[model samples]
Target: MGEPVRSLPHLVGRRLSRVVVLIAVILSGLLLGAGIEAQEADNSTANLPTDAESAVAARVQERLGTAEFTPAIVVFDRGGDALTDEDRDVVQRKLSELQELAAPGQQVFPVLAEDGQAAFVGVPISAETPEEELAEPVAALRDAAAEGLPEGLRAQVTGGPAFIVDLSQVFDGADVRLLAVTASVVALLLLLTYRSPWLWLVPLSVVGVADQVAVQVVAAATQVFGFSTDGASVGITSVLVFGAGTNYALLLIARYREELRLVEDRYDAMRRAVDRAAPAILASSGTVVLALLCLGLADNPTSRNIGFGGALGIATAVGYALLVLPAAMTCFGRGLFWPFVPRVGDADPTRSGLWARVGHAVTARPVVVAVAGTLVILVCAGPALGVKVGLSETEQFRAEPEAVTGQLVLAEHFPAGSSQPTTVIVATEDRDRVESGVARVQGVQRVESAGEGEGSAVLSVVLDAEPASADAFAVIEEIRAVAAQQSPGALVGGPDAEALDASDAAARDQLLIIPLILVVVTLVLLVLLRSVVAAAILVLTVVATYGASLGASWVAFRTFFDFPALDLSVPLLGFLFLVALGVDYNIFLITRAKEEAEEHETKEAIATALAVTGGVITSAGVLLAAVFTVLGVLPLITLTQIGVIVGFGVLLDTLLVRSVLVPALVTLLGRRFWWPGRLSHDGRHDGRHDGRQGSPAGHVAD
Candidate 1:
């Protein structure tokens, strides 16, 4: 069947060769994955377009020869009670020590809030500090703030620099944690799917090794490419390797088990299984890789890097699954299945079960089933219309870190936007004019000259609203507009302005990349399934699945998680993952159904296809969903939101859309479902029970 494709699995068929490949794969994974530890773990970017105003504002300072320094806010609070004189004395005593932590060209200054209950020390740390060494200065400041502190007064090191440190810290041991959790989840699911204890180990170990190897590859790629990657991307990549890699394993092993029933020789069975299933596996991986690579067109640096890293990981996973995994499986004997071992004459257990009945039920009333499934998807998607986009800076964390709390405290006790003020850079000659214009703006509370260097001057404008709020963003827009009118080259930036630009960039990227990804995926489906009708149907179903999953997840986020708004990247990233991964089940099911159609009527073929592929796809889907859910282990809100959305999307796609709706559509379409393909008019069919009465005989669940 795979004559055009060389049986790469069998190349390692020699007893010694199989063992050699297996051992080599494991060692490579270990040594290479360990190398990731040497690569820096912090790769996060603001995820904004480089040409945006905020980005230009950031660069203006560098060009003006002023060192880039980010402030670390040292916040001290006395709860509802006003700060006592003793509390003020302690802050005074620590001010000199905190100044020691500031960057060489910067200094620290203590300022008491008007409310007298909170005070802050703004400590500037050089932005040029290497990512690995960023925490050292922040840590020293935090230690100084904590020791010899008087009772009833507490302090937290926060603001931009501290936020960066905390965010990176959240991923300190995330790889090991995610790997351990993902591996354990995979092992458990595999063991359950194949009742034999020994059977589960084969695919788990193979996929596990692939995930570790992917980590090393991703880390190395980051160094060579110098693209912005972060701990969250690293975590997501590992999850993808385990989830998608193990899925390939499940599909392969299921076919292998089925083939074992007809082919007595275990080695021969493995070869036949690889020959039949490899194409679908390859097609599935191709679509995902291509779709992920489309992220290269994204404006967000993190999005582009994620696409690159995820694509590399998927390629690595598929390579190992098709090559190393097959060799590893063949090294074992039939006894690997233990009491459930397949015999040449034994009944294929997958022909009947929850899936067989579902097939029967679907065939009985294709129109009704199709209508009902569409309604479910539509209902799930309703809430999406009201979904909000763009979480505030402090909202980026699921669990409030000291930075977030400090920002809140600062907001409560000080003037509006006291925690962080918007920065504006302009030509030194026009600084006074631009500053005067900005000061007269409706939202401007005050404008202070930061410094001047070369031919440029910097202004820190305190706005009349909390940082990153809608009001603050509005103020930034007004400030920018005024700057453009009074001083054309003035650049406005800082936390609030950067976030504003990021939101706009995310919107722009969505418009550009979404259609591009859809086109890529659609073209891939068109190639994989030769029938235009089938390809169109699969693409529509995947779209519906994405919409439904996003809508449903938005509801969950609001109702249970109480999230204010989705991160700017969530909707686009969620759509990308759902579309790419959702097509996997379509490829698996429809390809199998196509094969069955050669020998059976259309309705009967689809029913039979469902019974056979149901168990494996369902198992794989649930396992993948669970692995994604493990992202909840990290504290970042963006990652958590992604995990929930994608996880739920996978479940919805696997359990409903693939299992019922698509099959029903095909059943109703009859032979026309395969129109333009040989199966529509040619090939063999027994014409037994044309899908109205008896469904295909057999249970397909594992």
Candidate 2:
């Protein structure tokens, strides 16, 4: 008689109980460390500003008089032909009202600019100004501008601080909408896949717990480390944490159910499930974790933080999957696969009509199938060459009234490049000469000499394009070239040009990092699988999938959404995530295929692998896609980019790469795919029990 399924779980339970105690102890320490880190992280901001940012601030201080750029700007148009008596009166009153908004520690500067038609009253916010202090002052200023205005004139206000506050207030509602939609769709998909509410709870509950742990831990860590999130990146955190967590849970549960179907006693089923599934899940999670950690190599603070947070999430999911999942499965036992409980029978590969056809087609003309699949990938990759890279923050709220108003004001008064333009600072003993040199540079609309000292002079060079644009890079290089000839002694430094330069340099660095990380990661897989050829092909397939996904995202965003080219970092991130996590499905499917091949013939092997592993990978992919879709619904362009790119990327990985590409490629390659391994040369391996049983059955049994 077959070994009782209960026996598997009993074995697991005996071993796991001991490990659980040790885990509890380690978890306690991590929790305490996290608590301490949380406090430290919260205060971390105080310790930072040491490097380039601080240097930039010091340079700006010379001409700006220590009055840093107030993130708040004031706008009130004067009556026609400059301010009339009435306009003057209104402006004075508005200024008076704005004074009341100034908190004890805050500073607000009132200024005026008049064109032929009207005048705009403005304010520059200080660096350390608090939102609470700015809100009331800004609101009062707006009210004053609104009152006593000339008939044709109107008053409006906009600024980064205000935008953040506005987005924050509305984000709660947006998040609510996002969560409701995500939960509904996900629940529907799960129910459809499982056909049982009882089994569906496993993934839902697991993902929910994992989400809490990831978010809370990341929040607590950032707070302790003193990392503050940008408004857009803040929204992204939710989608990433939940989406990845759910993907992990679905894979684990699917494997558990599949194992339970074959092993009768519930306990043994869970143990076998853990043994069979955990390795692939862990492998996938490990690759992702390592890739994210690679983000630490970035010079940009934003990229660095994202990398840290992402790595943390991947790591947490790995831990939960290996430990908590086992514990929970042990508790549920046979009931875990309830409503469609396994009948202690082998899976029948030919049971599904769909599988029968796919199996026949795959083996019938493997070359034709492989060539056709390759053609599809090459065709989809065409748009990738047209991809561009840049971001417009205002695009986040293209439909919002405030964003529209803000854009109008900026276009009318400010330089088109005013949104964080690249400032080229040429410091020299001859300040006046350096300023003249900067002004002469092509594309430089204006140059302001800042600071007064014996050794230094800071010149702010405003370019004609947004700082993140390719044009801006050209402008910066022009300024540098001109300044080098004119001011041989000047030190050039500013946030605008420096940030762009750093980002470009970082992108180059990632190119090298990708291959290095890939080799290291693939090596790990190689050791685990003990097959060099399998490792090489797996990496190659994942790369193809990533490229296809990126190309598709470029078209979707650029053509459909009318977004600018994909984010510069998207390719790097896409490579890391798809390559790492994408390989998980490969490991799951291929390993199973190998086991089947050991016992059954090649045709039967491919059929059996798909029957057992396909459903689980598909479910996992959908869950991941649902979670990522939350990013698309957010009101920020950055998150939206991340959402669509990753969501589509995962889909491509599952539907195309995992489902067709890898399987077809493996079938075409056949035994050659596992070269140098003992299994490849010999027709036997101990892992396959089918051979001993004479291949009596070669199909999934429901």
Candidate 3:
């Protein structure tokens, strides 16, 4: 019997060697195919939901017999001095040169600042301009300004077009940086976790392939699904694949190492390890995938892309971790562990480690521990209710870029919204009435007939408030109300209007998608745990953690970061990640508890499970948190906010919720924690079970 058992691994390893080589070939082909088909990611707001602003923009374009145009503002400053005749002449010549470069039927206009220290040239470029095509026109305007500008005068290009060009440049090579940082973080963490230099390379290599494969898969899926890809989606996909894939690898490898000490053959140990780890990994991935898929119901285009793309990436990570990783590790045999290889009959270190002490303490006073944990999370959750959503365009950047600086200068000298006027498109017949109504709006500083179309006219209404400000949003809303009364089909569209619409869409998405995600996640947990009570506890705990994280982040954003308000998409995306990822730790803990309960009493099972899984789960959580924290390296405020919130939330879930709170709650609940399941009403109902079932017997401190 012993000889056959020992030989089983060799036989299986020999059979799998061919399969591993085939998988390697397939992965290489996938990588090559992906590289050949790679295309530039689109981050345009043209895919925003067909809200009022979008509909209005379309109508204006149709009426004018031209496509929508993005406004570019060139601000010329004379260093707080009144412009001289020479400066004015130079500016006028540059303005003319800029106008000459405009598309047919498009016009450029110049306005002097109230203080006479600055002036702006507004040039409208066709909105249909491809991203790569934008740099040329913008550069021409800049070059024209530089050609003959007076010594004291300085010109900067800003506004919608300039912002787009600059933002695209910021993200140009961001993928490489994000990948480098994420890979380094994961590799270092894995090295520390495994305590072996060589073991970390195997999982890291497999995960690298997984990350590449995920990108191609998600890109293809988005194209087929008719959803657009953005820089955020592409960037986050790498982070998710590496962070989550490595996590799954850690859990599997830890189990494989444990099985190695029990089983004589390396192949048999890995097979048993895969069997033990796959379920938890699958359950955790399922929760995240299902939750992210709920983003499809969102009204925001970016959210939708993230939802579908992130889900696909996670699914890909699971596949590689479970299938490719296991095969690769088995192919390497026992040598993969190197200096720390586990031998048969060796004791599990987890039997009495830091986790054992944690389990013992929590089991001693379950109620006290549970109550204290709940209170701590609740305290952190206090600020979330008052979180304000929506950041001004300038606030979107962690460090102010040239465009933002130009906007600030323009805002200080001119009507704040002059750089990007609120556009009201109305039928030519009602143009006069609609124009009068818009001009009469409370915040309208000035109104002009910027252009005319076949049967409609474009009314550019400059507001007293900054273009992306909340006051400007309110003013646009009022203008829309007035337009509806005077010109029934009039469309209100511009920078401020677009921002307003995005905020509304984000709010709607939060309301719609949040509930859907929670319901989906709850149902998934229920099915995976096979216990309604356990699933409910897990969901509630994660939700609590999410609230705590958001609330804490709100304080951090306002107090430390000095951000005026949260980005429109932050709350929705943050919730999606926190809930989905936070629940993962719970899944890791409870699944092990269920398995342990098959042999021991409920309380003893909880303690033993905690001692066994505490280290791996904590390491996984810390590793995921660290990878996400790398997002802060980017200069985008949205990414920074996401990194801080998700990183902090993961730590909270891992240390407080999973390590202490969950074990205490399960201990307090006893057999009832698994209500309606066979384990809940078995012979071990009274915490008196002692014998092992179906596996090797081991001691678990009570």
Candidate 4:
């Protein structure tokens, strides 16, 4: 019997070793497969949902032939002076040079502003030109404009093709910068949390691998599901994978450190930690995934793509955190904890630490804490009601790009919509009526017949208002109303009309998707917590946090950033991120509390759970906020606003709502908090299981 028992230890070690190797092989295979598939992935507008604007675009494409073309406007200004004959001759020569350089199927036309202080040459890109090939023609035009300009004259390119070129340049390597910043932030946080030189690299490396895999997976989704993807969606995927994966890593590692003090063998310690942490991680991830998946029901293709990509990222984060991280850490053994390694039989430091004191204070005056928290959140949320949605093209960028500069110069000397004319497609026979109706619209500066087909004709209506401004959208509505009376089948489309349609689609999506997301997330929390009351409380807390964040962000945007208006997509996207990620922290806290309640009375359990999970949750929250803040560095207003709103919201959830308000409510409703659950029926008297015997005095916890 002694001989067999002595061999048992070797047998267990061998089995554990085999398990680790198997996990590594599986992860490696997955990485290899993802890498290969990613090379063939497509990210383009070809997959955009057939919304109203898309239908208009399709009709326009059919009329114009298969080649997609965008106009490049080259604006030339001679300060505020009228053009002399010499200036006109110089500009005409430059325009002729530009026209000569135009590609096949392209056309260049020169128009002098009525004031004659500025003139622009409009160069149409060839329909045969691919998206990647647009820069060549735009570059040629710029180079042509650069040479031989007269004194006091300046020239720059703007308009659709030029804007695309500039935008592409701005986003070039943005993913790399975001990844670098996120990795650095997460690495520093992990190092501080563990105070170990080597421990941070393990989870960081795993998350990096997981991030790459997630990108490929999202790319795969775009190809397989016919969903559209843009630079914004791709950037968001990286942030989610890194931020969420690191968050799960922090929670699991923190719990593993605690379990190490209770279990002698590293393998057993890991098993116990994973078994205990998996539920909270899964519940949190599931809530986020379900909430994001609701975006698929959105009318906007961008929202659908973000929903699918974000959901996939959360799922991947959870998988690697629960599977790969644990396997890798277990293989590394006790040395992973380094200098402050936990020893078996050591007492948990959290039991007498800051959160324990905080828990006491919160429980002592639950009503005061709850009311104060509620009021603070409500005050912050009040500003959200005043939020205005819709950003003009000029407002989309934080700093003025060349395109915006050119547009401004053009606006100074010409009709605001001269560069981008609203196109009306009507029956050939009704063209005269449609053109007359469009000419009579309030903002219409001029109307011209642009092209004609077998049974249809295209009319270009130039407006006096900025093409992408609110006034322009209103004018489009009038034009549409007029067209309906004159030409029943007329299709109105242009840069301004497209913007209006997009804004309307976003508004519809918000109304349709918000309630759907709320329902889905609430159902998920109810199932995960197994208590309707607890789930409802969590939902309410997250909603309040979202509103507060949006309100605060709106103030920041107006006062600090000098933004004129919010991006059309910001509100819905911000809501999705805040509510989903906010619930993540709640799930972490409440799940731990539920676990503790099994062994202690409700009050003591709340105290113990808060004490044990406080540091890790706070660290995770800070890391996530920092990661999101990196989005601001990209120079896009939509991304910057989202970063601010979501980052601020996560901090709010961590420090106030999850820490104080939630615990206070749980304390005040002791046993009743978990109504209809076994814990409610099995609960011991409050404050009795632990050493405390009566109501404690209120005091702030760290």
Give the whole-model CA lDDT for all candidates, comma-separated: 0.83, 0.61, 0.81, 0.80
TM-score for all models, in order of appearance: 0.94, 0.83, 0.93, 0.92
Superposed on all Cα atoms, the candidates' RMSDs to the truth, in angstroms, are 3.7, 5.4, 3.6, 5.3
Shift of residue 47 alpha carbon in model 4, Å: 11
Report how far off residue 300 is in candidate 2 (Å).
Answer: 2.4
Give the candidate number with the greatest lDDT: 1
Question: Number of clashing residue pairs in every model?
Answer: 8, 29, 0, 1
Off by over 4 Å in 2: 1-71, 76-93, 99-118, 130-153, 159-184, 220-241, 333-338, 346-353, 396-404, 417-428, 453-455, 460-467, 488-495, 601-603, 682-702
User: Residue 302: error of model 1 in Å?
Assistant: 0.9
Q: Write the per-residue lDDT of candidate 4 for residues 373-462, one digit (tens) a residue.
A: 999999999999999988877777888888889998888888988887788887889999888878988999999987777677888888
Q: Residue 15 of model 3: what lDDT?
A: 70
* Candidate 2 to truth, TM: 0.83
| lDDT ranking of the models | 1, 3, 4, 2
Candidate 3 C-alpha error for residue 477, in Å: 1.5
Give the candidate number with the greatest TM-score: 1
Q: Of the candidates numbered 3 and 4, which has the greater lDDT value?
A: 3
Model 4 residue pairs with clashes: 67-127
Off by over 4 Å in 4: 1-49, 64-69, 79-85, 681-702
